[model samples]
Target chain A: MDYFRQAWAIAWKDILSELRTRQMISSVLLFCLLVMVIFSFTFDPGAEYVSELVPGILWVAFCFAGTLGLERSWGAEQENRAVDGLLLSPMDRSAIFLGKALGNLVFMLAVELVTFPLAAVLFGVSFLDVWGKVALVAVLATAGFMAVGTLLSAITVNTKLREILLPILLFPILVPVILAAVKSTGSLLQGEGWEGISSWVKLLAAFDVIFITVAILTFEYVVEE
Target chain B: MEPSLRRNLLGLATFMMIEAAIFMIFIWAPTEQVMGIVQRIFYFHVSCGMTTFLAFFIVFLASILYLWKKDKKWDIVAHASAELGVLFCTLVLLSGPIWARPIWGTWWTWDARLTTSLVLWLIYVAYLMLRSASRGSERRTRFAAVFGIVGFVDVPLVYLSIHWWRTIHPVVIKPSGIGLAPPMLYTFLVSWAAITILYFYLLGLRIRIGKLSEGVEELKAIQYSGV
Candidate 1:
C-alpha cells in the first residue's frame, strides 16, 4: 500500500509539474503533428499507398516524438539534480522507476490522443471505426516503448552525447516493440480485427513484461553511483 | 600452461585448424546441386552468425557477473565480449549481403534472421558507444553493466518477435533439422570450431590489452600527481 502510495506520489509530482508547464506534451504533439503532415504528402488521401503508409507513418511519428519527450523528462530530472534527492529519499528505487515510467506513459498517451485524430485528418482516413483497436495497440506499444525508453533515458542522461546517444541506445532494443507495433497497426488499419493481430499483441505484451521487469530490477544499478 | 606458451600454442592451433577448415571448405565440401560455388559463402557466413551469438551470450553472462560482483574485471570481460560480438556481427551483416546478392538476387531483404542480426549489431554498437561515453566516472561501469545486461536480454526477444512473422528467409535449422549433407555438415562443424577458437583468442587478447591500458593510464596518473 505504501509502495503504491510512493509510486503515486512520484507520478503525481511529474503530472502536477506537467500540468503547470505543459512544455513536454506540447513539443511532443507539435513535433508529431509536423511529422504527420510531412509524411501525409506521400500518403495521398484515398491512394492505395495511404492505407499501407499510415501504419509506418503513425509509428515513426510516435516513436520519434516519444524520444523527444523522454529526453525532456529525464533531462529535467538530471539537470535539476532531482534524481539525487530521489535517490537519497530512502524510497524504493523500483517504485521511483515505475512512477517515472507511468508518468512518461501517460504523457505519451495524451500526445497520441491528439496525434491520432490529426493523423486521420491529414491522411483522410476515418479512425472512428477502429479507434478502440488502434488505441489498444497504441497503449500496449507505448507501454513497451516507455518501459524501455525511460530506463535508457536515465542510462544516457549523464552521457557526453545524450541527445544522439538516446536514440542510438534506444532504437535497436526497441526494434521488437516497433516491429510488433507496426505489424499490429498494419493489421488494425487493414480492418482485420483481433484474430489477425493476436500474435503481435502477444509479442508486444511479452516485450512489455520482459522489459518492464528488466528495467525495474536494473533501475537501481542504472541510477546508482 | 604458461601464458606465452599457451598463447603460442593457441596461435599455432588456430592456424592449423583454420588451415584444415579452409581446405575442407574449398576441397572437401562438395558443391551444391542448386547454388554452386556461391553457396560456399554459407560456410563462413553462418559460422560468423553462430559465433556472433556465442560472443553475445558471453557478454550476457559477464554483464550479470559484473553487476553482481561489481568487479572491474567482469566489466572488462563484458566490454571485450561486446566488442568481439560487434566485430563478428559486422561480419555476419557483411557476408550475408555478399551471399544474398548472388542467391536472393538482391542486396537485402527484411528476412527475420537478417533483420534480427541487424538489430543485434546496432544494439551492441550502441553498447560500445555507451562504453566509450562512460569516462572518468564510476557511473560509467555501472551504467554500462546495466545496459549490457539489458541489451543481452533484448537479443533473444528481438529474434523471437521478429521471427514471429512469416519470413521469406529459409529456416536452415527446422523442426526436422540437421538436414545438411555429410560433407556440408562436416565443413560447417569444422568452420564453427575454428571460429570458436578465433573468438576466444580474440577475447583473451582484448582483455589483456584492456588491462595493460588500464595499468598504463594508472601509471600516468600516478606519475603526474607525484603520488
Candidate 2:
C-alpha cells in the first residue's frame, strides 16, 4: 500500500507539472496531427483502400508523437538534477520507474484521445462502431510501449546523444508491440471482430506484462549512481 | 602458458579447423540433388547464425554480471561480445540474401526466420551504437548494460510476433529444417566448430584491445594529475 502510494505521488508530481505548463502535451499533439496530414497526402482520402491504411497511419502518428513526448519525459529531471534528489529520497528506485511510466502512459493517452478522432475525420474512415475495441488495443499497445520507453528514456538521458539515441535503442525492442498493435488494429478496422484479433490481443497483453516486469527489475541498475 | 604462446596455439588451432572445414564442405560433402552447389552456402550460413546467437548470449550473460558485480572487466566483455555479435549477425544477413536469390527466387522474403534475424540484427546494431555514443563514463556502462538486458529479453517476443505476422501473409517458402545426410552432417559440424572457435578468438582479441585502451587512459590520467 505504501509503495503504491509513493508511486502514485511521483506520478502526480509529473501530472501537476504538466498541468501547469502543458508544453509537452501541446507539442506532441501537434506532431501527431502533422503526421496524419502528411500521411493523408500520400493516398487518395476517398479511395476504397483508405480504410486499410488508417490503422497504420494512426499508429505511426502515435508512435512518433509518443517518442517525442518520452524524449521530454526525462528532460526536466536531468536539467534540474531533480533525479538525483529523487534518488536520495527514501523511495525505492522501482517506484520511480513505475511512477514515470504511469505519467508517460497518461500523457500518451491524452494525445491519443484527440489524435484518434481527428484521424478518423481527416482520413474519412469511421471506427466509431468499433471504438471500444480500438481503444482497448490502443491502451494495451501504448502500455507496452511506455513500459519499455520509460526505461530506455532513462538510459538514453545519460548518453551524449540524448534524445537522438532513444528511438534507435527503443524501436527495435518495440517491434513486437508495433507488429501486434498494427495487425490487431488493422483487423478491427476491417470489422473482423474479436475473433480476428484475439491472438494479437493476447500478444499485446503478454508483451505488456513481460516488459513491465522486466523494466521494474532492471530500473534500479539504470538509475544507480 | 605465456599469453602470447596461448594466443599462437589458438591461432594455429583455428587455422587447422578452417582448413578442415573447407575440405569437408567443398569435397567431402556430397552435392545435394536439389539445391546442388548452392546448398554449400548452407554450411557456413548456418554456422554463422549459430555463432551470432552464441555471441549475443555471451553479451546477455556478461551484461547481467557487470550490473550485479559492477566490474569493469565484465563491462569490457559485454562490449566486446556485442561488437562480435553484430559482426556475425551481419554475416548471417548477407549470406541469407546471397543464398536466397537463387534458391528462394528473391533476395528477400518476409519469412519468419528471415524477419526475426533482421530484427535481431537491428537490435544489436543499436546496442553497438549506444556504446559508441556514450564512450567514457561509468554511467554509460550501466546504461549499456541495461539496454543489453532489455534487448536480449525482447528477442523471443520479436520472433514470436514476426512468426505470427508472417503466417497471416502468404509465405513464399515454407521454412523447414533440412535433413542432412551423414557427410553433410559431418561437414556442418566441422564448419560450426570452426566458426565457434573463430568467435572465441575474436572475442579474446577484442577484450585484450579493450583492456589495453583502458590502461592507456589510466596512464594519461596519471600524467595529467601530476602525482
Candidate 3:
C-alpha cells in the first residue's frame, strides 16, 4: 500500500509537472509527425509496399521520437537536482523508479495515440480494423522501450553528452522490441490478425516482463551517489 | 608458478595450438560436401561468433558480481571482456559477409543470426562508449555494470525474436548433427578449442594492461598531489 502510494505520488508529480509545461509531449508529437512526413516522401510504395513497410516506418518514427520524450522525462528532476531529495525521502527507491516509468509510459502512450491516427491520415490506411491489436503492440513495445530507456536515462541524465548517449545505449538493447513490434505490427496491418502475430506477441510480452522487473529491481543503483 | 613463466607457457601453448588449428583446417580436414573451400571459413567464423557470445556472457557475470560486491576488479573484468567481445563480434560480422558473398550469393541478407550478431556488436560498442563517456570512477563503474547486465538480458530475447521473425533464412549453426563428416568435425572441434584458448590469452593481456594503466594513473595522482 505504501509502495503504491509512493509510486503514485511520484508518477503524479511527473504528470502534473508535464501538464504545467506540456514541453515533452509537444516536442515528441511534432518529432513523430515530421518523421512520418519525411519517410512518406521517400518512397511512394503502392498499397502493397505501404502494407509491408508501414509498421517498420511507424516503429522508426516512434523509436526516434520516443527518444526525445524519454530524454526529457527526467529532465525536470535532473535540472532541479531533486533526485537527491527523492532519494532522501523514506520511500523505497523502486517506487520512484516505478512512478517515473509509469509517468513516462503515460506520456509516451499519448504521443503514440496521436501518431497512429496521424500516420493513418498521412499514409492513407484504415487503422480502424486493427487499432486494438496495434495498440496492444504499442503498449507492450513502448513499455519495454521505456523500461530500459528510463533506467538508461537516469544513468545518462547526469552526463554532459546525455542526448547522444541515451539512444546509443537504448537502441542496441532494444533490437528485440523493435523486431517483435515491427514484425507483429506488420502482420496486424496486413490483416493477418492475432493468429499470425501470436509468437511476436509472446516475445514482446516476455521482453516487457523481464525488462520491467529488471529495471524496477536494479534502478536503485542507477540513482545512488 | 611465477607470473612471467605462466604467461610464457600460456603464450607458447596458444601459438602452437593456433598453428595446429590452421594446419588441421587446411591440410587435414576434408573439403565440405557443398560449399568446398568457402566452408573452411565457417570454422573460425563460427568459433569467433561463439567466442564473442562467451566474452559478453563473462561481461554479464562480471557486471552482476560487481554490483553485488561493489568491487573494482569485477568492473575491470567486465570492461576487459567487453573490449574482447567487441573485437570478436567485429570478426563475426565481417566473416559473415565474406562467407555469405561466396555461399549465400549475396553480401548480406536479413538473416536472423547475422542480424542478431550485428545487434550484439552494437550493444557492446554502446557499453564501451558508456564507459568512456562517464567521468566519475564509482558512477562510471556502476553505470557500466548496470548497462552490461541489461544488454546481456536483451541478447537471448534478440535471438528469439529474430528467430521467430523469419523462417526462410538459412540456419547458420546447429549444435547437434546437421551432418559434418568425421574429419571436418574434428577440425571444427580443434579450432573451437584453439579460439577458446586465444580468448583467455587475450583476456589475460587485456586485464593486465587495464591494471597497469590504473597503476600509472595512481602514480600520476601521487606525483601531482601529495598522496
Candidate 4:
C-alpha cells in the first residue's frame, strides 16, 4: 500500500514537472514527427504499402524518441544530485523505478496520442480498425521496455561512459521485446485477428512480468553505493 | 595453477588424439551404405555442435555462481567457457557450411539450426566485445554476468527454433526424427566424451593463465608504486 503511494507520488512529481516545462513531451513529439516525415520522403510508395509499413515506422519512431526522453528523464536526476535525496526517503528503491517507468510510459503515450492521429493523416490508414490493437502493442511494449529501461538507466547512471553505454547494453537485452512487438503489430495491421496475435501479446506480457519482477528484486542492488 | 592439474590437461590432450583416431577409423574404415565419404564430416560437425552447447551451459552455470558469490574466480571460469564455446561454435558453423556445400546444394539457408547458430554467434561475439570494452575487473565481471544471464535465454529459444520455424537439418537422431544406427550412435558418443574432456582441460588452463596474468599485473603495480 505504501509502495503504491510512493510510486504515485513519484509519478505525480514527474507529471507535474512535465506539465510546467513540457520539455519531455515536446522533444519526444518533435522527434517522432520528424521521423515520420523522413520516413515519408524515404519511401516512394502506394497507400497500401505505406499503411503496411506504418506500424513498424510508428514503433521505430516511438523507440528512438522514447530513448531520448528516458536519457533526459534521468539526466536531470543525476545533474541535480536529487537521486540521493530520493534514495534517502522511506520508500523502497524499487518504487522509484516504478514511478519513473510510469512517468516515462505516460510521456511516451502522450507522444503516441499525437503521432497516431498524424500517422493516420500522413499514411492514409483507417485508425478505427487498428487503434485498439496498436494501443495494446504500445502498452505492452512500453511496459516491457521501460521496466528494463528504468533499471538499466539507473545502473548506467553511475558509469563513466554512461551516455554511450546505456543503449549498447539496453538494446541487445531488449531484442525479444522489439521482435515480439513488431511481429504482433505487423500481424494486427495485416488484418489478423486477436487469435493470430495472441501469442505475441502473451510474449510481451510475459516479458513485462518477468523483467518487472527482476527489476524490483534487483533495483536495490543497482542504487546501492 | 596446480602442477598435477596441468599434467592432467596434457594427458587429456593425448586421450583426445586417441579418440580422434578411433572416430576417424569408424568413419573411414566403414563402407558407406547410402552417402559417400562426405557423410564422414557429419561426425565431427554434429559432435562439435553438441560440445558448443555444453560449453555454453557451463558458461551459464559459472555466471550464476559468479553473481551469487561475487567471486572473481568464477568470473574467470565463465569467461573461459564463453571463449571456448565461441571457438567450438565457430567449428560447428564452419564445418556445417562445408558439409552443406557438398550435400545441401548451397552454403547457407534460413534453416532453424543454421539461423540460431548465427544468432548465437552474434550474441557471444557481442558478449566478448562488451567484456573487452569495460575498464576494470569488477566492472567487467558485473556487466558480463548480467549479460551472461540474459544472453543465455536465447539458447533454449534457439533449440526450440526448429519447432517454431522451418529447418533443413536432419532431426533423425533426435526423437522428432528417425534414430541413427548403433555404430553411428556409438561413434558419436565416443567423440562427444572426447570433446567434453578436452573442453574442461582447455577451460582449466585458460582460467589458470587468466589468474596468473592478474597476479602479474598486481605485482607490476606494487613494483611501480613501491608500496
Expressed as tens digits, the lDDT of each residue in B95-211 for candidate 2 is: 888888888799988888888888999999899888878856687788888889999989989989999887432332246844667889889999999999999988989999999
Q: What is the Cα-based lDDT of residue A13 in candidate 3?
A: 92
- Per-residue lDDT of A1-225 in model 3, one digit per residue for the tens? 989999999989988988998887887888888887788788875555776777888899999988888788777777668877888989988898998888988888998899888878777777799888888989999998988899999988777688999999999888889988888888887889779888888888999899998898789888887
| Count of clashes, each model | 0, 0, 0, 0
**Pairs in clash, predicted candidate 1:** none
Consecutive 10-residue window with the lowest summed lDDT within model 3 chain A? A44-53
Error of 1 at A7 (Å): 1.1
Which is superior by DockQ, 1 or 2?
Answer: 2
**Predicted chain B of candidate 4, TM-score versus the true chain B:** 0.89
Number of the predicted model whose DockQ against the real structure is largest: 2
lDDT of each: 0.87, 0.89, 0.87, 0.76
Question: Please, what are the lDDT tens digits per residue for candidate 4 over residues B1-227?
Answer: 77877768676675866567465546434544766677666776777788788888877788778878888888888899999999989998998888688778889988878877777776677667667766666777776776676667545533452334466787757657537676676666667667777777788779889899889988998999988
Comparing only chain A of model 4 with the true chain A, what is the TM-score?
0.95
Lowest summed-lDDT stretch of 10 residues in model 2 chain B?
Answer: B166-175
- DockQ of all models, two decimals each: 0.80, 0.82, 0.79, 0.26
How would you encode candidate 2's per-residue C-alpha lDDT over A1-225 as one tens digit per residue? 899899898889999999999988988888888888898789876899988888888888888889888888888898779988889979899999999999999999999988888988887777789889989999999999999999999888777898889989899899999988889989987888999989888989999998999899999988876
| Accuracy of chain B in candidate 3 (TM-score) | 0.95
